[model samples]
Target: MRRLSTLFAFTLIVLGSCSPSVKILGSWTSPSMSTTGYEDIFVTALTENILARQTVEQDLDNLLNEKGVNAQSSFNILPPGFKTSGVDKNEVLQKIKALGSDAILTVAVLDQTNETRYVPGTTMYSPMGYGYYGRFWGYYSYYNPVMYDPGYYTTDKNYYLEANLYDAETEELVWSSQSETTNPASIETFSKTFSETIVSQLIKDGLIIKE
Candidate 1:
């Protein structure tokens, strides 16, 4: 069975709301490498949206730190004008080295899709009985009219993201995972779940030991 990438059952889920949460689509870990965790990991999220980049990286940093692992968000260390579309590999790596980060964690959006769904209206039974005859009339009078609640169409958005962990010293990918999040209500909520899920998966894959 494919494992669901979740360490904690986040309490923010709203019933029938399709609240934002991350679920792994697939993942792979390097086969040749033995299990040992990195001492310090530098976290980066690729996005043009500054808020999103900051939110996820900070959340990841907090979770990793709680596990006794050192984690730093690139937002705090990188230049303000850095763009995700293109980056200087050597300069970036040199910065990571300066931070004493032994591992590099990067997150990027893979895809986004929107779905529009129709919710059928609901009927309510109401009575406004009065007047008239015996059993037949009484039964007929028991209910007056059918009331309907108007239905609406709603659009749902799904986000696909991929996370990769690299051995900073070797610059070799140690693990990679792809995840899907549906109907994220807000960036805050998405970042909360996304960071939690990624941290949990790293521990599971033995990339970040929970010491």
Candidate 2:
């Protein structure tokens, strides 16, 4: 019984330790922004890497669609050679409008940094640490706090990203956010969590409604 209990406790600790840290650092929604979220939204990723950009946009599209939000990926709509900047702004706007997109959702990885950290090991003790098995077994049962082997070094990556919602008709920014992602398990996980976070904020700001 004690062995099972110890194993269960250790499992919980390991799961908690491996959880990723993701957060929205700041966000702003224009007061004049439409309260009713766009029914047809176009998603885009500004990452220079073609595959990464497509993956991110597709992830966002899938998540938003799951929530009953109408979303399309710019990667699919635009040509392979399309560039975000140094292009004809009017032509880009025309293309987005032609798709019946009322709003544009853009995501970009602004910066990234790596950090090394060392965590010192420590020992712990409990009051009811050990007890002799009562009459029958004549054995001992011990309850000990888990101890770390030694201090260890780890390298962590921090991804700084920004997202924005634009009013396609007026060509104005409606909402924007800055977020930080630390040590995401996978790109898929990061994209899902990031998209969900932004959508939740939009709901909170009365920009989007939960279906």
Candidate 3:
């Protein structure tokens, strides 16, 4: 009886972990979009496109990994122009069908911009107490310790991504999501972090995993 109980508990834990946050059961693919005007303030146009594509691909792969789905075996990344025609649902469906995909995930770069600021500060003093001779005593303080200030630091640029999922067989809209944020001044420092955060959010939202 003891051994049976232990086995049952272990099985439950495995099952729980196997459960996915998203429901991307059928085969899936992403659409290709023009890379023009997608440049960031610091990253070159070519580099921005490459980073965006890699981020989106990584997000998709993370979704698959969470759901235990294999893209190479169960999914495929179709060639460009599959859904770039801006056609109606039926036409899009036809296009996806031609690519041998049961479902399609389209990601569009709606907007991409960036802003940068260099913050400068000095030590602040706060009157703490009075000395024996009635002189004031103060302590040194930092102007801003939290690292985020609205007035001193601001962002003028933002990045936006619009994602849409469609059913190829039925030509029906399945899922849609968007991600937008202030562009980091340094792409080298922020690209990977931003990508991982977006992917993690997608998974947490249960929008890109299989059950």
lDDT of each: 0.76, 0.71, 0.39
Residue 177, candidate 1: alpha-carbon lDDT: 96
Superposed by TM-score, candidate 1 places the C-alpha of residue 144 at a distance from the truth, in angstroms, of: 3.3
lDDT of 3 at 72: 18
What is candidate 3's lDDT per residue for 133-174, written digit by digit as tens?
A: 443222222222324333466434444544555555554555
| Backbone clashes under 3 angstroms, per model | 0, 0, 2
Clashing pairs in 3: 22-209, 23-209
Q: List the residue pairs that clash in candidate 1.
A: none
C-alpha-based local distance difference test score of model 3: 0.39
Model 2, span 1-211: residue lDDT tens: 0122322322222233234566999999898898677777888876445555666788878877877778888865675566558888888888888988889998876666668999887766544423445533333223334344677999776666778999999989999998877777655566667778888877777666668
Per-model TM-score versus the true fold? 0.78, 0.75, 0.43
Which candidate, 1 or 3, has the higher lDDT? 1
Which candidate leads the pack in TM-score? 1
Worst 10 residues of 1 by lDDT: 7-16
Q: Which stretches of candidate 3 lie over 4 Å from their true place?
A: 1-48, 72-100, 113-123, 126-156, 185-211
- In model 3, what lDDT does residue 45 have? 14
